[model samples]
Target chain A: MIVGVMGPEGSYSEKAAKLWMQKYSMSGSELRYFADIEDAFLATVQGKSDISIIPIENSIEGSVGVTLDLLLENEAKIVGEIVVRIEHCLLSKGGPEKVRVILSHPQGLAQCRHFLKKHFPDAELRSTGSTSHAARLAGEFEEMAAIASPEAAECYGLKVLLSNIQDKKENYTRFIVLKAGKKTLTEPETGSEKCSSSACKTSLIVYLEKDRPGALYEILGTFAKRKINLTKIESRPSKKELGDYYFYIDFEGHDSDALVKDALKDIKAKTDTLKILGSYPAFKTFRSVNIDKGY
Target chain B: MIVGVMGPEGSYSEKAAKLWMQKYSMSGSELRYFADIEDAFLATVQGKSDISIIPIENSIEGSVGVTLDLLLENEAKIVGEIVVRIEHCLLSKGGPEKVRVILSHPQGLAQCRHFLKKHFPDAELRSTGSTSHAARLAGEFEEMAAIASPEAAECYGLKVLLSNIQDKKENYTRFIVLKAGKKTLTEPETGSEKCSSSACKTSLIVYLEKDRPGALYEILGTFAKRKINLTKIESRPSKKELGDYYFYIDFEGHDSDALVKDALKDIKAKTDTLKILGSYPAFKTFRSVNIDKGY
Candidate 1:
């Protein structure tokens, strides 16, 4: 199986794709690198790769809204998902004392803000294309250090002077593997037989009629009256006019479920546009808050 | 009057604050600068300045979420507001022919992404603390251009190699003049009397009760039924649990209006905690958009 990831040779997405290949596939498995998650999805759709892993959300920074926007606009379906626990480390060429500057992705630098504030507040902080790039840069320039993964440090032949330096210990990224059409992996609990049970999530994008009174309420009430628990609801501007919006919602039931089907019908009646983005496993295990370190 | 703005020196906030001082009743103004908007707010709350000018939102980037977060957390009240049209220029000392690198704030660079992609796709881009800082660096270097305001070019003695270089011509930033307590401003159109009419937009921060189901929808239903137009709603982590959130909402219409008052009453009954942040004029002006020059 070929896996698609984001890269310019060495990115976190590349590392993630490699990890997946090692854990679940063959040693000589094919790997494809796209400039962005969108390109990766397109490649998967065009049969370039079997699946593409795209980051959906992060703990500290919240949702990667761009990914959600792309998913809403695209036709790919999420087949499976994974959550990687991120452990950011400060890697230098020789040691911590030799470091006069630090470089990493802006998000990486922000994630480790508290550590930098308390320890290296005076050091010039620079941003690079990726954590891996930062690690590579630090290896080339002895005066520079990088905030990146332990795996990156190892790959770049760097020494980790600090570990788990992120501001929040619960920092994790949820990645979804997308395919052209629907497919299901075996349930984690029961791997004995081929079960026809569907996934438990119904993700949708809804655009309400302009200034329609009670439109949002009417759409949400359908789920409320049916005892459906909404896992998420985020609004983005339709980018057409002021106050115009499209809501992205995730509810706790399959689209085929009677209640969810009824709710969608109700929402369709009330909204100008409704797009069922996808229905897939909730991945509750992958979303558990992990706090293995202190601030 | 003493005005506080975000800067070490020569930031966009400084220019915005100066414009505000010139336009308003600050006949003899004392200007102060802070490193960030949060610091500006604190200085205002602590009586360091009569008012602080802070950028609340940008057209391309949406709201400056940090500014909004600080406003929610701080003690200062917004007294007046303004919008500044932003037109970024590429300033260089080495001429466009010699320029090989571009530098500016990440947001500034992001706003000019389309322009950069078209003209300087190969130019190495870097992030600086502010556009003015980038200008300063460009003044001392060769083969580099600073993406900043023309005002910054004047301040730093850099020549504008490319003016109106931003992707969107209608780029604008909404700035709020903050004070320690609410003070009514004289109506620009009718200076005869103090405008005592309640603010048209009502702002609220709400927290839902634990184990609540459909609480947000039930509360929002109140406004939906009353035909109130919610301008925006953003969810911030309550920092208590994995999925719990505190929602910040803005809706059109005065809270004193019968329908709005009734809606709030119903909402208060359902929400675990709800605070009226404040209400003010919508500030419906396109001062930041349709600019004729690169400022």
Candidate 2:
């Protein structure tokens, strides 16, 4: 199996891909690195790679807008998900005191905003394409430091000047595993499958038809009336107008469930556009398996 | 009047701040520059600056996540809004063929994504703190190109190689004017106020008490039954857990409106925390004023 991700072999997306392979009991998987996230997703969608893992949200920064945009405009369906704990470390060839320039991916720099402000207030911040790329640059420059993972520091032969430098303590990122064929996930034919209806969650993209007062309320009622709980509800611009938007929603329950199907049917009839991104097994359900076994 | 914004001047935020002042017919306003959005907002909230202008969303890139997070965490209230047409340009001191590196704010780079992919695929892309800052660097390096506004090119003394390079032609960004006062907007004492209930919009942030199935539906019902329309409804993670979220909603109606008051009363009772950002005359109302006179 081939897995494509935004990577130079040490990015968070690469780590998520490996975690996903372990959870699914899959092996002999090969990893392909791409500098751009869009390019990575495109490779998978075009069948250049069998699967793609992309980060969708971070605890501190909220939703990854570009990733959400790609999901809305693409044919990829999420087959699985993994939550990776993020711990940003400052890495450089020279000591921390010698750092005059700081290079990182924009998000990486933002995540470590407080730490950078307090310690290196005068350092010039330069943005790189990826955290791994930043580490590569840091390896060649003595006056430069990079905010990246420990793996990146190791890969580029840099020293970890400071670890766990992000602003928030409970920082985590959610990455989705996607396949190109389906618009929505359907029920499994076999009874031995782990992703049963109760353990899965559904994700959708919705756009309203007109400026009705209760249009959104009516849409929410379909899920509420059936006792379905929403996991997430985010809005993105439709690019057509200022106030207009495309709503992205993630909710509990799978397409195989009768109540979920009913809610989706009602939503499809009410909204102008309804795109089902996927129905995948919840990450918590998979994580608890090893925890329950005390491993 | 004094205005605080993310700037080195010639940045999009500075342009929006100026547009906001013009729309309000305000004079003698001086602009204060801050490297970070949070600091700009803090200066306003702390009364260091009379007002602060921050970009909230772009038509192509979606919500500015950091700004939304700040709005949720701070006590600042929205006093007005302005929409600025975004026109990105490729700037350099040298010719395009000699450009080996391109610098831009990530959003600037993203907005002009198609233009860059087709032309400068091999050029190294570097992220900067702001578009104007990118222009500053391009002025110093002959081999470097920058993606920024035309104003930035002029300010930094660089030649514009190409203009309107954004992926979409109708690219625009929305900026909100915020003040440090008011938890919720109340009716004005005099009838002379321009922001009457008819032409105003009230923005709110709501967090639910528990995971009830109909919690959000019930909250929306308050406005729907009152015939109030929602302009925008975006969700950001609460950062507490995976599925927990804080909903940001903007709807048409002023606080003085009886039906709007009714909805607010109900929403306050249904949710754990309800923060009213502000009630201000809609941007459309303000923009139409000069457009009607063909200016």
Candidate 3:
């Protein structure tokens, strides 16, 4: 099996991929890295990689717009999810006094704003393509430091200058695993299942038939009447015009389930467009090291 | 009157402030620039500025998480809104061939990714606090170019090397004007109006009384039954734990309106916490320069 993620390597996406593998007791999977989230998804669709793990949202930053947009545009099916706590660390080759420049992915740098403001007030902050790439740069430059995962520090032979540097301690990111396939409206066959799990979730993108008052409320009513729990709801611009949006919703049931199917049917009747992104198993807790801990 | 905004004088926030001033036909308002959005909001809360124009959401990028988070934490009230189209330009002191480094706010750089990849694939990309700040640095460095607004080129004495470099053409950002005040549930008195508008919108942060199934669906039922249109709905992590979230919602209608008031009453009765961000006039279209048009 091959897993695709945004790279160089040692990024949070990789960490989530590893956690996903461990949780499912899967081994011998090769990890492939791409330059961007869309590229990772594309790799899966093109059969270059079997699956792609991509960050969908973050606790502090909210949704990853690119991932959401790409999901809407691509044919990949979400097969699983994993939530990883983000712990940013300041990694460097030299001590704090020796560092004059800081490098990181933009989000990584923003997460450690307060720590950097107080300690590296004079350092020049630069954005890189990925945290691991920043780590590589930090390792190569004596006067440069990087804000990244501890795994990145170890991979690049860098020392942790500061740990748990993010402003919010409870920061977490939700990642979704995507496979290239058309999602079926029916549930998977239980007896001859290639991959199946209990506790399923169904994701959908619903567009209103018309721009009318209470349209969304009526749609939510479909699920509410059936006592279905919605895990997430977010509005994304349709890119056609202002005020036009495509609602992304995640609910707690597989499409094959009777209750879920009825609700989706009602929603389809009311909505102008309804696309089921996929139904996959809900995320369960898994054990992983504190990423903030220094190597 | 004084208006605070994130700036180096040519940011989209500054443009929105200018547009707001023009729409209200107000004059003699000093526009003050801050290094960050929070500082601009703080200026209003601390009485340093009468109002602050802050970007609430972008069509392509979605909500500005920091702005939403800060509004929830502070006592600022939304008073007005303005939408500005984002147009990115590649500005530099030297020609495109001489540019070795590109700088801009992370969003600006991301928006122009396609342009950069096609034209300057080898150039190093860096993130800055503001697009105008990137323009300033680009002006100072002969080998550096900035992906910024055309206004920044004029302000920083840089030449526009390329225009309309963003990947998307319909990119627009919505900015809200905030004041330091608590919103009253009652409708504003028309005769003794200190501030009032005809078409209004009320924004709120709603927290469920408990994590019950269909809790959100029930809440939407309140608005749905009232035939109220929800402009937006998003769930932000409550920072308490996983699955716990605070729903940020914007709906058409003033809190003073009878139907809106009744919906709020019902929502408050069922919610654990309900905070009214404020009621303000719905956004109206305004004429502004196309950002992609080169100087």
DockQ in order: 0.37, 0.66, 0.58
lDDT of 3 by residue, B1-295 (tens): 8989988888888888887776666677899998767678889999989899998877666677778878888888887777888888999999888999999977787677668778977788887777888898899888999998999999999999988888778787788889887776774622112333236678999987334878887888898887887888877767566566788998888887778889999998987689898877777423343333211
Q: What order do candidates take by lDDT, descending?
A: 2, 3, 1
**Predicted complex 1: DockQ:** 0.37
lDDT of 2: 0.81
Give the clashing pairs for model 1: B84-B288, B85-B288
Could you give candidate 3's fraction of true interface contacts?
0.57
- 2 or 3, greater by TM-score: 2
- Model 2 per-residue lDDT tens digits across residues B1-295: 7899987778988988877776666667889988767778788899988889888888888887778888987888887777888889999999999999898877888777778878988787776667888898899989999998999999999999998999888888888888876654574522113576667888999997446778888988888888888888888878786567888899998887888888898887786689988887778776665632111
Question: Could you arrange the candidates by DockQ from highest to lowest?
Answer: 2, 3, 1
The predicted structure with the larger TM-score, 1 or 3, is 3
For model 3, residues A1-295, the per-residue Cα lDDT tens digits are 8999989888998888888776666688889998767678789999999889988877766777778888888787887788887888989999988999899877787667667767876677898777888898899888999998999999999999888888778778888888887777884722112223236778888887335878887888887778887888888777665566888898888777778888888887886688888877776423343333211
Best by DockQ: 2
All candidates in order of TM-score, best leading = 2, 3, 1
TM-score quality measure for candidate 2: 0.94
lDDT of 1 by residue, B100-157 (tens): 8888866677668668767986676766656777787788887989888888888888
By lDDT, is 2 or 3 better?
2
